[model samples]
Target: MRIFLLFFPVFFFCGLLHAQTVKVEYGGDPLPDKDRKKIEQFLQHEVDFYSQFGLPDTLSLQLYVFENRREAIDYLESINVSLPIKASGAYSPKLQKAVILGRENGRERSLAIIYHELSHHFVSQILGKRPPSWLNEGLSEYFEHCTIHKKAVRHTFTEYEQGRVRTMYMLGEVNLPTFLK
Candidate 1:
């Protein structure tokens, strides 16, 4: 009877673990092991980042890492049943998940996209609410320029590529103000 009582609670607790478990469903082009590990680590960090705010749950999030933006957009459009943003990554509120391009120029670019999308999920859960769209997106962008050192994440602001920016502006490129009418 003593053994039965002890084992029964353990068995019940196992099911609770299943209920809140996070599952990353992968589709599209095959990714190298290196990229896959990066994705997993970033996702784990995102959960820990938000959980620090004393959320009741562990901030479970699903990540879908596509080999390119096309595959990511295709996945989003199919599930969203609406036009998906044509971008490196996006967070889906309906699915409570993140879909992102796993590689572009390099691992750093991919890491930036991962952080940007993951931040969206983090802010919403950590604060038990979301900030305005502009603030949320700005925060994500700021976090995108981040570095992980010895398990510590540090965000750094980088100026836009100096040489390229100067050349483009010299060649008549302009920064137009956003006009929403």
Candidate 2:
């Protein structure tokens, strides 16, 4: 009984390491310290916004930024999932990590994607359940680009998603009320 009790604590601590509330591991690509700080600041702002809005408390998620899609995909595939065909960034709730393309898309887009994934993480906490694919995707796209201007918050939609909505509106496929609901 003493042997089992001692080993159990060791196993529990090991599990805790994989579930860090906050961790960001950079790859060999060498992200500049300036960029890293900016990213952290943006993420922290998101966390604060959600907390102030009466959502669940903040969550700690590990972030992995690789130099390119290949590296990201390789690392992702090493996990139990299949390779992503054309993804730049993603949040794996099961793993509690965000995997992203570090160098390829440049800072603006990369930051947008990171915010998008992190938004998903928080939104999941709000619903306390997995949202439908469209809701998950729409909310993420809505949060992908956030800007504060003169005490006003603006959210920019992804180009593809925005274009689709515009096209639908033009074609009378969607009306304001239907879209809102």
Q: What is the lDDT of residue 124 in candidate 2?
A: 68
Write candidate 2's Cα lDDT for 127-178 as tens digits: 6557677877877777777754444556756688789999999999999688
Give the whole-model CA lDDT for all candidates, comma-separated.
0.60, 0.61
- Tens digit of per-residue lDDT, candidate 1, span 48-144: 5554554344335566666666666667777863434456777775576777654766877877887887788777765545568887787788778
In model 1, the worst 10-residue window by lDDT is: 1-10
Model 1 alpha-carbon miss at residue 97, Å: 1.8
Q: Which numbered prediction scores highest in lDDT against the true structure? A: 2
Clashes of each: 0, 1
Which is the leading candidate under TM-score? 2
Cα error, residue 99 of model 2, in Å, equals: 0.2
Model 2: residues >4 Å from true position, as ranges?
A: 1-29, 52-54, 147-153, 157-181
